[model samples]
Target: MIGLAPIFSYDDQLKRFLLEDVGSGDVTTRSVFSYEARHRKASAKIIAESDGVFCGGPFGSRILSYSDPMAKFEAIPDGQPYAKGECLVAMEGALESLLLCERVILNLLKHLSGISSLTASYVEMVRLLRKSSRSLRITGTRKT
Candidate 1:
C-alpha cells in the first residue's frame, strides 16, 4: 500500500510486456495443450528463493488477471518481509493461462523484490547509524 500507482497507469506498459512475451501467440502452449487440457484448472505458487522485503504481488495478480480473467491470483501483501521458500503469490486457473504467464510474472517479481530488498537494507543501515536524527531522509533518482 505504499503509494502504488493507479492500475490504469500500467495498462499500456502491461500490454506491451505481455505482447513482447506472447508475440504471435504462445505456439508451444497452443500446440501442446488440447482444448480440454487448456481449460483444466491448476494451482501454482511463486516461492521466494531468498529472504527479502517482498514486493509486486499486486502487480503479478494484475498480470494474471490480464492474461485470463477467470484466473484467481492471491498475492502476499506488498512491502511485507518474507523468508526463503515462502509463497509470495498463489494462483489458480486454467493450466494454459498459468503456463503462459509464468515467466513474465516471475521476471517481474524478481526485479521488483530485488529493488525492495536493496532499499530496505539501505534504510536499515541508515536507521542503525543515526539513531538520534529523525529527519534524515533517503531518496532515489529517476534512474532505474
Candidate 2:
C-alpha cells in the first residue's frame, strides 16, 4: 500500500479552527474538570460518509495521538482504498482525552477526504465531457 506520509504541523489553520470552535475557551471542559483532569478510557470510531479513494488515515491517527498522548489509535494502512461508510480508524482513550483530540483528528480527515472527493468529481466530469466530445464531428456540406 502506498504510504502517503503524514504532515505534522503546528500551523494557523488548526490553531484558528480551534480558536473559533473553542470560543472564549473550553469553559465547559475546564469548569467540570481540573486543568489536569483525567477520566475513564473510551473508544471512538471514525467512519467515512461517502465512497471515494481513502487517504489520511495515518495522518488522522497521528493528529489524535498528538492531541492526547494517552489516546491510542489503529487506522487502516495509508492509501488503502475504502468504501462508503467504512471505518477509517478506531480511537481508544479517556473520554476527556478523546474529546480534547476530536476536533484536530476530524479536521485532518476532513481536509484529506474533501480533497479526494473533489478530485474524483473532477475526473468524472472530465471523462463525461470526453465521451460527449467524441460523439460529435465536423461534416462538410455542399454549397448551394
**Highest-scoring model, TM-score:** 1
Q: What lDDT would each prediction earn against the true structure? A: 0.86, 0.69
TM-scores of the candidates are: 0.86, 0.60
Lowest-lDDT window of 10 residues in candidate 2? 8-17
Query: Which number leads on lDDT?
Result: 1
Q: Mind giving the per-residue lDDT tens digits that candidate 2 earns over 34-116?
A: 54554767799888777766567766665555456767888877655677788988999877667776776777777887787
Clashes of each: 0, 0
Alpha-carbon deviation at 129 in model 1, angstroms = 0.8
Please write out the lDDT profile of model 1 over residues 8-53, one tens digit for every residue. 6676786777779987667898998898998899999988889998
lDDT of residue 130 for candidate 2: 78
Collision pairs in model 1: none
In model 2, what is the error at residue 94, expressed in angstroms? 1.6
